[model samples]
Target: MHLSVENLTFGYGSKPILKGVRIDGIGAGKVAAIIGPNAAGKSTLFKCLAGILKGTGNIFYDGRPIEAFRREEITKHVTYLPQEGASNAVLTVFEAILLARQFSVSWRVSDDDLVTVSETMEALEIADFALRYLNELSGGQRQMVSIAQALVRNPDVLLMDEPTNSLDLQRQLEVLSIVRKATKAKGMTTLIALHDLNLASRYADQFVVMSDGMVYASGRAESVLTPQMLEDIYGVHAEVSIDSHGQTVVTPMCSARNRIANRRPEYAQLAV
Candidate 1:
């Protein structure tokens, strides 16, 4: 499957948020990182793609307009894991994941569904919390359960917004590695909204850099995460280099404002 968005324009009432956003395409079995500074509309873009928010534009799955499909039909092919997970649900972790597998079922829970849920929990290292209620778990645990829920659905496209949020460094690496493996094994088109540039560079096959509700850059992380882009878009004086593992490393030296202020006395007030 191929995913593409063109001329996407969305706003909150009269205030525009996304202005003519366009992504050429993301092929199946690939992970694309949606990266940007705060308020760049990364989360909003995920909502529109998942059909949680209706925006004016063309969203196509394999050249077919998403608007042409019904809500239920769209859900079958796309699954979205939000940044802040829902903890209000009273269901146990196992039940919640099992329920997610019912999107295409006919009330009867098959052995395959049970196996999928159990395997997903195991894969996510959350099987121990199977009987625990969602409300009882900590923020990080709930986030893991939320990831399990999305994966059990077996969707063609997965949209994960900050899936590593609240997780420790080890869990961050584990989760992303597992997600990348799943994308390849299932041929799933995955897009993740990430603030950690280094992590995105390590895991993502492609990068979609967002800025002020628009695509500032999109391509390989090595090409997009340039020092110039860091200074211009992120307002940082950064050193971009490749690690021994061939991952792009971005080390921020200082704020662009402070750099200018140090050289030009007149701009000191702005930095202060």
Candidate 2:
């Protein structure tokens, strides 16, 4: 399945967060990175797609409007992992993951649910902490548990807001690798909001660069993460280049104080 958003807009009171944003070509099994500066509406877009927040726009999944799906259908197909969640839930790691799985099961948990939870935890490398309480775990460990919870649901559309938050360098890489594998294996459409441009370029098949509530650019990392695009949207004087591995590398040398001049209308027209 493919996800498309056209003329999407949302706001609080009169202040808008998303201004007629259009994103396309997010197909099944592909990981797209929702990237940009702070308050760029990456999280808001995820919420809208997950049906958590109602926003003005036409969101289509495989050419069907999002509104056509019932609440239960949305819940079953869309899985959202927010940037922050209550970490003091008085539940063990295993129990927390099992609870997430229970959302799709009956009152009496089935053997499939148990096996799914176990497999998800093992895939995330958090199976060792099954007996540990959520309150007693570190921030990174809690994040891992949260991830395990999201993965066990086995949704078609996965929206993860900064899944790497609070994780150390090694853990970040490990978790992302698992997520990508899961996405491809299940043919899931995954969108991840990431601040680390290098990591986004590495893991994401497509890039959606948001700036000031609009998509400043969308396409491959090499096309969207240019030096000029970085200066225009992020006000950073950066060097963007390809490494020997063909990965896009962003090196911010300094900040361009006169950022207003860099915001060109032509950049907004960029798309894949």
Candidate 3:
């Protein structure tokens, strides 16, 4: 499946957050990273795509406009994972995951449903927490369970906002690797909103850089993550280089203001 957004516009009551955002060429089995500074509308865009927040323009999935689909119909093809994993529900981890598949399963859940939930938990290495209450688990543990819920749905399109917010370095890599593998194995079109540029560079097959309320850049990592793009979008002086493994590495030196102040002493006061 291919996903495309054209002239998408959304905002709060009177304040516009996204203006004429356009992104194209997100193919199946590919992971696309949406990177931008805070309040740049990355999360809003994901919400719009997930049908949680209705926008003005068009969102196409495999050439069909998404607006035509009903909520249940959309749920069959799309699953959304939010930034935070905090749940006020008193349900256990196993029950929460089983509930996620309730939409697709018949009235009474069968043994197959239980087995599927179990396998998904094992895949995420969260089987030990199956009986634990969602509110009682740590933030990282909850985040892992949230991902397991999404994966259990087996959607064709997976939309995640800041999926690695509370994970440590090791867990971050493990989660992203699992997501990547799942996307390819299921031929799912995955869009993730992320703040870590290095992680985005490492896993994303395509990069969509948002700035202000528009798409600042969109393409492969090498083409989109240039030093100039970093300075323009993030206001940071960064070095973009390829590592021994041919992966893009972004090393941020300092703020753009500081870099300018150091180069020209006369403008040093402006940095403050």
The alpha-carbon deviation from the true structure for residue 166 of candidate 2, after best TM-score superposition, in angstroms, is 0.1
For candidate 1, what is the TM-score?
0.95
How high is the CA lDDT of each candidate model?
0.92, 0.90, 0.90
In model 3, residue pairs whose N, Cα or C atoms come closer than 3 Å (at least 3 residues apart or on different chains), thus clashing, are: none
Task: Report the lDDT tens digits of candidate 1 across residue range 152-260.
Answer: 8989999999999999999999999999999999999999999899999999999999999999989998899999999988999999999999999999999998887
lDDT of 2 by residue, 81-134 (tens): 999953688899999889887654456788998999988887788889899899
Name the 10 consecutive residues with the lowest summed lDDT in model 1. Answer: 263-272
Query: Which sections of candidate 2 miss by over 4 Å?
Result: 258-272
Q: Model 2 misses residue 143 by how many Å?
A: 0.4
Which of the numbered candidates is closest to the native, going by highest lDDT?
1
lDDT order of candidates, top first: 1, 3, 2
RMSD of 1: 2.1
Off by over 4 Å in 3: 104-106, 264-272
Return whichever of 1 and 3 wins on lDDT: 1
TM-scores, all candidates, are 0.95, 0.92, 0.95
